[model samples]
Target chain A: MNSRLIIANIIRWLILLLFQILILRNMSFYNMATPFVYVLFLLLLPFGIPNILLYLIAFGTGLTLDSFYDTLGVHTSACVALAFVRILFISVTVRDGSDEPEPTLGNMGFKWFLLYAVLCIFSHHITLFFLETFRLTEINYTLLRCALSSILTLFVVILIEFVFYNRKVR
Target chain B: MRNLWIFISRYNAFFFFIIFFTAGIILTVRNNIYQRSVTFNSTNQVVGDVYKNLNVLKKYINLGAVNDSLAAENAKLKTEILSIKNIDTTKETVVKDSAGIPQYTYLPARVIKNSITNRNNFITINKGKADGLSAGMPVISPIKGVVGYIQDVSEHLATIRSLLHKETYISVSIKKNNAVGSLIWGEGNFDYRKAQIKDIPNHFKLSLKDTVITSGFSSFPQGVLVGTVSNTGISAGENFKTIEINLFNDFSTLQYVYVIKDKYAQEQKELEAKLTNEQ
Candidate 1:
């Protein structure tokens, strides 16, 4: 189980890295679009991974992307914040369970999984974009960019999970 | 000791969170310093090459407008040629043979990508070092109105600092009287540029529809048209004047442009440098 999870985490990082560098970097609609796909690595970590490790992974993933994009550390700060919030998001989605791991998806019904996935993705994207556009002078345009990128990110993350996640078991 | 070890193991994730978060914040704060580690900046040769390819894709979309502007410029040039031919040299005291030709050379180029909505807007053009293009050269639309100045240059691509830039200052003058003023850009809309005509005598009585032209102080020649005054007025206590001139060029649809290279620029700059040192 340990080897399987580690390998899955590596694969998830690889996929997210490629999606960010190759497909999303050039995507634009009137200068308000740049897809933030690196959040996928943080969003899909197994529930059992230690929160410290999760935060470290999230921050590192974000920094790696920032290094390439010349954007400094906006992604890193926001991704770490998102990773810290994931546990609360999971708990809120699965209130009845006491000892059971906070399920990212399978244990929850389809409706709950969709809700949980969207909220986590949205939280990460919104914070990440907002912090990136910290210069208040450009608030209106930055808000537009954040909102559009968040919606697109939500659609992309779910589509990726549906295609790649195991269907037979939780 | 047992309790301490248990606490350490239980909250390891929390400790990791602090470490990663700190690293992230430090990186964000020192971004410019950290940017040295980046190998793929927009100015990098590889990135420049990639954008050059993207220019090809953009050209297709702008072809129609580009062709129209070219046609218009061609018609104007033909008329100019005819007028020059009909001139009787005996009646005109010509200083030199080159007076008829523009002292500034033009390199025709295409705008690959341009943005005007942003406060700090820039334009990417298809011509660069291979085409003798360099930064500091003036870029103008085919209609001969000012557009922007080249800011960056690669082997085959260059970026222009748009006229919309807040800091852009160009020396200009009133076309009719040669009244000199510095042209300054406003924050948002680039369709207009304000000219501050300092020390204009209160007696001149400036009015609306006054024509503004490029001052000879720049590499741009004296008569290159800028715009006409939308309004003019005296400031609260200032003796000089301030005039708001509506620009002739529409930045939104800029396609074809001519990059002007002043033939005497190098010698002029060297003379100015010498004059400054002597003082």
Candidate 2:
């Protein structure tokens, strides 16, 4: 990526991280579902940004969140898992030699972006809640937390996507 | 050997993923102990400062609710003070002087960060070791209701494991009969407003809305309000009754709290340690 694009990405990462920890961290539905909008950073990272770089970035983002949430590596594990899911989903759906644009609602189209987001986010939430609870007896509640949080996160992500419709970045 | 090298090169990303994922798992496993050191949490210097500053802005929005709660507390304390003064201040003063420094001192602090949605919830406050606060200092909402105790302390911040957490248990007694039980979390932990009390003997009468207060056995000073008994059932153990209670503190809107400093905590701890060592 060009230096200008790199700077833009860094700024976006910081903004999303702050927004997630400061605002969304405090917003929970009946102490069950919390919208994790910070994952947008990983979801929209420039395509073909080397898998290693993507995972490392995801780990850092999750660690920052984990510090604020006092959740230790729970978010880190989930973020790394989400990074893997992101690469796998993109590879399966987007042809390897095809023109690559950043994954956003405007560029990827609604249907494709929705599928990509749901698949990736659910992977993150499921990993997060399951690792957090870490018990088989509470599987039902854990799954409920994952599903509710994933839906809330996806809704917020889409709402933000619509509000800030990005032009196709060259 | 060439094919093996090419295979490793091709899957280098997966190897990196495995390495980081393993580290994450290790951290998660050791997280309970990791919290002892205040490095990787909201109490960390940078994160604590951010929360402290952000609280300045958020406090404005919450002023109305804070006012209402404080007003109620004021009214209650007025009547309580009137009654205490009428009883015999001179005699109480004599007793208090003989007792040395007050057993528990209250250190006022602001709640910079709180969480209620997790199975294990923690609250971060702006007071820390510099203010003579330390781990195991009992924290309570104003008007002295049970909240939690300090779990870890840094220079200017401390994290409290709230009663809403799965592991938090406080010794409590029914006000009517003085029957003792342990207050614990879960049985709908998502409903942060509720907690469960177990080990009350089945023979004791437990009615709905019976007031529960701290029994002085635990770290808390005696008589701090816990909650009212909301439900009672047969505990798995034959002799014990499972009781549920409604917590008073709405952790969602919790802004300020008092961390209790016990003058006798260190001395008592040393005595207990010596007893264990003797055994």
User: After best superposition, candidate 2 residue A10: deviation in angstroms?
Assistant: 45
Give me the runs in candidate 1 sitting further than 4 Å from their true place.
A1-170, B1-64, B90-102, B187-203
- Fraction of true contacts retained by every candidate, in order, equals 0.65, 0.56
Best by lDDT: 2
| lDDT (Cα, tens digit) per residue for candidate 2, span B1-279 | 999999987877777788888888778877845433433543456777888899988899999988987898899989988988798755665334364766778888999999988889999998888999989889999873889989999878889999888778899999999999898988654688888888899888778999999999989988998888888666565888778888777888899999888888899999899999988
Candidate 2 pairs with clashing backbones: none
Q: How many clashing pairs per prediction, in order?
A: 1, 0
Per-residue lDDT over A86-124 for candidate 2, one digit per residue giving the tens place of the 0 to 100 score? 988887898876665478898888999999999999999
Q: Model 2 off-target regions past 4 Å?
A: A1-170, B1-43, B89-100, B235-237
Assess each prediction's global lDDT (C-alpha) against the native: 0.72, 0.86
Tell me the lDDT of model 1 at B265: 77
- TM-score, candidate 2, is 0.52
lDDT of 1 at B249: 77
DockQ for each model: 0.27, 0.24
> CA lDDT of B90 in candidate 1?
77
Report the C-alpha lDDT of model 1 over A94-123, residue by residue, as the tens digit: 454344343544445457767766777677
